[model samples]
Target: MWYLISYVEEALKYIEANYSEAVTIQDLANWLGLERTYLYRLFNSMVGMSPQAYLLDVRIRQACTLLTHSDLTITNIARSVGYEDSLYFSRLFRRKKGQTPSQYRLTHQSPESNS
Candidate 1:
């Protein structure tokens, strides 16, 4: 059980480092030298979410950071966060965040000075 837990942890670390790229379950399983279905079951049972779901969650969280801290345009931000299509990214952001990216940025942006 502890071995499986460590395996999942390693998988999560890899996912965090490569979430901006097209990381897939098969890729992870191949890298871990485990069967795809077995890895998926272990990961889902331990993490309470599938690998793909976790990847999307990570990507959206990164997008949130870029939205709040950067002045990059929405399209550019979307691309920077591994989204090739800003419209699709906006839709996904709305679904996950309950607001469009632009709306989120506007509401969360730091106050500007009149100077």
Candidate 2:
């Protein structure tokens, strides 16, 4: 169990570091030397979400950071977060954050960034 937990942790770290790249469950399993299905099960059990879900979460969270802290354009920010389709990214961002990225930045941007 602990060993599985460690694998999940490593998977989480990989996701965090590579969130701006197109990563897949198969890639994670290959990196961990585990079967793809097994990695999915273990990740779901350990993290309460599938690897894909977790990846999206990380991407959106990173997008949120970029939105709040930078003056990058929306399309650039979308690509920066590993979303090649700005429209899809905006739709997903709306689903996760209850607003478009622009709205989020408007509401959450730091005072210094507001200048």
Candidate 3:
């Protein structure tokens, strides 16, 4: 049981470190030396989400930080978050954040960054 938890933790770390890349569940499974279905089940059981869901969550969270703090264009932000298609990123961001990336930035941008 403890060993399984450790694997899940390692999976989380891997996603955090490589969320900027085009990572997939198959890649994660290969890295962890587990079958794809097994990794998915373990990750979902431990983290309450599938590996792909967690990856998208991480990417969206990172995008939120970039949007609020940097002047990067929407396209750049999407790419920076591992999304090659800006339109798809926008749709996902909207679904997760309840707003478009631009709107999120407008509302969440730090006052200091306005200087």
Candidate 4:
């Protein structure tokens, strides 16, 4: 169990480091030194999904925080979160957030925005 915890921690760190790049399951599995199938099992066992899902969730969560707090443009937000194409980023954000990125930002202004 501890080994798995360490594995998850390492994997998460790698994701954070490389989330800006074009990451794939095979690449992430290789980076973590785990067989793809076993990695999938371990990730699913611990997090209820594969690493890809976790990475996307992390990105979306980060985007949500950025949206509420920052004045960056939508495309900039998308790029900051590893998306080169705002269209795809917007689609992904909407899929996860039920609103476009702009709408999310507009609706979720933070204290900074008030100032």
Candidate 3 per-residue lDDT over residues 21-75, each given as its tens digit: 9888899999999999999999999899999999999999999999988889999
Error of 2 at 43 (Å): 0.7
Model 1 lDDT, residue 50, Cα: 91
Models sorted by lDDT, best on top: 3, 2, 4, 1
What's the lDDT for residue 43 in model 1? 91
Residue-level lDDT tens digits of model 4 in 1-115: 8999888878889888878777887898888888989888888888788899989998898889889988888889889888999999999999998999989888898887655
The reply for model 2, stretches above 4 Å from the true place, is none
Error of 4 at 34 (Å): 1.4
Please, what is the whole-model Cα lDDT of each candidate in the order they appear? 0.87, 0.92, 0.94, 0.87
Return the TM-score for candidate 2, rounded to 2 decimals.
Answer: 0.93
User: Can you give the TM-score per candidate against the true fold?
Assistant: 0.88, 0.93, 0.96, 0.88
- The digit string of per-residue lDDT tens for model 1 on 4-67 reads 9999999999889987776787898899899989988999999999987888899999988878
Tell me each candidate's RMSD, in Å, in order. Answer: 2.3, 1.2, 0.9, 1.7
lDDT of candidate 4 vs native?
A: 0.87
lDDT of 1: 0.87
Question: After superposing candidate 3, which stretches have Cα over 4 Å from the reference?
Answer: none
Model 4, stretches more than 4 Å misplaced? none
Name the better of 1 and 2 by TM-score: 2
Cα error, residue 40 of model 4, in Å, equals: 0.9
Q: Model 2, 2-42: lDDT tens per residue?
A: 89889999999999999888778788899999999999999
